[model samples]
Target: MITFWMQMRRTIRLLWSLFKDAETRGIAGVTTVLLLSGTLFYAHVEHFTYLDALYFSFTTLTTIGYGDIYPVTAVGKIFTMAYSVIGLGVMGSFLAVVVKKISQFDRRR
Candidate 1:
């Protein structure tokens, strides 16, 4: 338990340092906007609760596609297709930035 907490603390510190970088902040901002837009769209269009919408958005963006919940309407389906493509790209970029930053941080340490 102590080891787990120490690892969590280290991860949080690393994330904070990563967010301080300009490139990471830019990608994070874009990713945040994408996630929020998807969450809001699903909530309004699918009549989902905010929590459900956010879950769907995160799962969709991460390409998890649990299929437990999905878009019912035609517009919702179309939006989801486009959203998946764009969100996946944004997520990929965000991950790449984080990985690069972590590697640099490790090297410095």
Candidate 2:
């Protein structure tokens, strides 16, 4: 089992590595912040549970409107539009990172 000190050291090391990978880190950080804010807004405005809010946020961000939940308020709609525009770039960057990483792995094989 990892001790608390070990975990802290490990976390720090991983964070440092992520910081070194500036493009990946920036994309991930922006995505996380946007998703968190969107989830919080949805939960507060639409009275959704945290899990539901997160799910809805991911679904919407990925452009997979399952029609399970939707925005009724004007603010929510506006936020949705904003999220779509900004989140798509973050998502695209993440996808680029994933593809690049995969290609690197493939080259090693």
Candidate 3:
């Protein structure tokens, strides 16, 4: 029973590590897509689609709110605030990791 438990623990740790790596990559990709889509949305602010609106929200929350597109409604403002609070931390952390990786790469060069 003890040996079985030890094996299970090792397996769990391996699974957790894999999950963490995947989560970090997922966050980074999501952040980049949101930024790109947001920029596109801003460029075509008027008569935008639902996809454009979502893109705008993500970009704005990430603190890259290009003045090219802005919310004109009170509800939109409230939503923006909420989105920013939730999305900023994830985006910021992902950005920090990216920068750190880049700097490390530069050091090796």
Candidate 4:
């Protein structure tokens, strides 16, 4: 539990820093939309709880894929496959911005 909060705090700080750039902010917005769409899709199609749907969406998009939750329905599986493909690109774009930020910060020191 403490680790989770610490991680969240780290994430918040990273995002706050990332949003200082317009291009990165745009990438973040698009990534957020993709994740939200996936979350809602799972909640509607698989009837998962909101938090579970959100968790599944995050892990799936990030490709961390814990395998703790999965879709059993054929349609749900198909959608997940499609979502993952698009999400990879979306997440890739966002991560690129983060990497760029890290590089810029490193160069300053």
Write down the TM-score for model 1: 0.88
Which of candidates 2 and 3 reaches a greater TM-score?
A: 2
86: Cα error in model 4, Å: 0.8
RMSD of each: 1.9, 6.3, 12.4, 5.1
RMSD of 1: 1.9
lDDT of 3 by residue, 1-109 (tens): 9999987886676545544676567876786676565545444544456677766766576577677666776655665566577578867777676566546544755
Residues 1-109, model 4: lDDT tens digits: 9999988886776667777889898988898899889889999999999999999999999899999999989999999999999999988888888898877765765
Ranking by lDDT: 1, 4, 2, 3
Per-prediction TM-score to the true structure, in the order listed: 0.88, 0.73, 0.48, 0.81
Best by TM-score: 1
Candidate with the greatest lDDT versus the true structure? 1
As a TM-score, model 3 comes out at 0.48
| lDDT against the true structure, each candidate | 0.94, 0.82, 0.64, 0.89
Per model, how many backbone clashes are there? 0, 0, 0, 0
lDDT of 3: 0.64
Residue 106 in candidate 2, Cα distance off native in Å: 1.7
Q: What tens digits encode model 2's per-residue C-alpha lDDT throughout 1-109?
A: 5698887876676555555777877788888998999899999998889998999899988989798988889988998889888888889888888567556544755
Sequence-dependent TM-score of model 2: 0.73
Ranking by TM-score: 1, 4, 2, 3
